[model samples]
Target: MGLLLSSCVPTSGGLPPFVNPPASTPYGGEYANEILKLPVYPRSRTLDKREFGNGNSRVRFRVEGVNVRMIYNFFTDQIEDAGWGRNRLESEGQNRTWQGVYQRGIRLVRIRVQQEGNSDVYVLEVTFLQ
Candidate 1:
C-alpha cells in the first residue's frame, strides 16, 4: 500500500520548474525618458524598460519559441549593424548564460541573456549608451 501511494504521487520535476530569477526580469524600471530601439525577437515581450543616469538605458524582456544560439546571433548582429563593434562575448554553458558587449567609439552597449533551463523562454537584459 505504501509503495502504491508513493508511485501515485506526482513529482515536481514533471511540472514546470521555476528559474532562480523570475520569468519577468527587468534591468531597469517600468518607464524611461529615452526609448532604446532595441532589437526584439518576433515573439518577444517587453517586461520592463527604463533609463538611468547620463542618458544610459536598459531593458529587460523575454523571447519565446527560440533557442539560445538564435537569440544571441540576432542581437549581436543587430548591434553590429547599428555601428557598434563586438567587444566581448562570454558563454557559461554550465550555467546556461551568455554575456556580450558592443562598442563604437565612446558609445557602448551590453547584452546579457540566459535560457531558462529546459524552457522555451529566454531572458534578456540590454544596456545601451544614450
Candidate 2:
C-alpha cells in the first residue's frame, strides 16, 4: 500500500521549504558601519561591505578606477585569486561605475591599488544579496 504522507514528505535533493516575511528596514549609516567594522573585512571604505561567509563566495563590487584588483580571502579568510580566473567577469562601464556580478563563494578582502590617479579613489560597495 502507498504511504499517505508520501506527497507531504520531502525527497532528497528536493527544493527547500519556502517562507516569506514582510520586507525589513533598510540597512545603512552606523548600523551598516558597525557591520563593516566586523573582523571579516579589512580597512573599511566609504561604502563598507558586510561579509557573509559560508563555503567560498565571490563579492561583487563597483569600482571607478582602472587596473583595480581585489584582495579576496586573506589568510584564514581564504581570499585567493584562483576563483577569479575561473569566474572571469564581464564588465560594461557606465558613468563612474564598473558594473558586474560575482558568485557567492569567496571572501573579498580589499581592492588592490595598482596605479594611482586623480580618480583612482573609487567608491566601493559590496552587497550580499542571496
Candidate 3:
C-alpha cells in the first residue's frame, strides 16, 4: 500500500523569499548545507554531491529505516515554509518514487526520493538550479 500527498503553489513576483531553517536541523551538517543550501533530512547518509558551477549543484543521500512518504513530506513542507512556491509534485507507487519542484525568485530546487532496490533504504536527490 502507498499514500501520496501533492500540492502546487503559484509563484509570485518580487524579491526572493527568505529560506527558514528546518525545525529539526538536518544530520548532514555544514558540508551538506554548503552543497545543497537546504536542510538535509535528519539521520540521512550522504551518498554523493556534485557542483556544476554557476550556482548549480546536486546532492544524493540515503535515508534508512524510513518510508518514502515521510521523507517526501518533510522536504515539501520545509520548502513551502521557507517561502518557496511549489511548481510541481508527483509520486509513483509502483516505482516508489516522489518528486517535487520549488522555486523562489530565480532559484529552482528539485527533490526526488526513490526506493533503492528491495532494501529499506531510500535515496534522495536534491538539485539546485541557477
Candidate 4:
C-alpha cells in the first residue's frame, strides 16, 4: 500500500529539487533542504506532488518520529517565521489537522499537517499558491 501510494507522485521531468524519493522512506535520516524544493519536516519523504494551472503546488509526504507534536510545532514556527500570517484557518487535534495560509497575493502559500491514523508516520501537505 505504501509503495502504491508513494509511486503515485510522478517525478515530472525538467523539474528541480524533486528527485525521485524512495517509495518507502526511512523512519529517520538527514534529508537535505536542497533536495526538497520546499522546506520539509525532518526525515520526511516526498510521496506525491501536484502543480495547479495557476502555479499553485501541493506536495504530500510522510514523516516518522517520536513526537508528532514536535513536528506540528516546528511547522507552525517555520511557516510564521518564513513570513506566513498567524491566521491558522483551522486547527483540531481530535481531527489531527493543522493548517495556515501565508503570503497573500501572487505568492500565496498554504501548509497543512495531518496525522495519518494510528500509523507512526504522518503526512505533510503544502500548497504553494502563487
Cα lDDT tens digits for candidate 3, 10-69: 226332346444476656577655544433354433322122123333222322311112
**Per-prediction TM-score:** 0.31, 0.24, 0.31, 0.32
> How close to the true structure is residue 71 of candidate 3, measured as C-alpha lDDT?
23
Ranking of models by TM-score = 4, 3, 1, 2
State, as a TM-score between 0 and 1, how close model 4 is to the true structure: 0.32
Residue clash pairs of candidate 2: 56-105, 56-106, 57-104, 57-105, 57-106, 58-105, 58-106, 72-79, 73-78, 73-79
Candidate 1 stretches greater than 4 Å from native: 1-94, 104-106
Per residue, candidate 1 scores C-alpha lDDT tens digits across 1-130 of: 9998887665575643343434653645543312233333543232221221133332323223111122223323221112224433444553455456565345455555555443434455655543
Winning candidate number (lDDT): 4
TM-score head-to-head 1 vs 3, winner: 3
Q: Is candidate 2 or 3 superior in TM-score?
A: 3
The TM-score, computed over Cα atoms with residue i paired to residue i, of candidate 2 is 0.24
Q: lDDT tens string, model 4, 60-113?
A: 232221111112233232212234464353344534545656664455556565
Count clashing pairs, candidate 4.
Answer: 0
- List residue ranges in candidate 2 displaced over 4 A: 1-39, 42-44, 47-95, 106-117
User: How accurate locally is residue 7 in candidate 2, as Cα lDDT from 0 to 100?
Assistant: 65
Q: Which parts of model 3 are misplaced by more than 4 Å?
A: 1-94
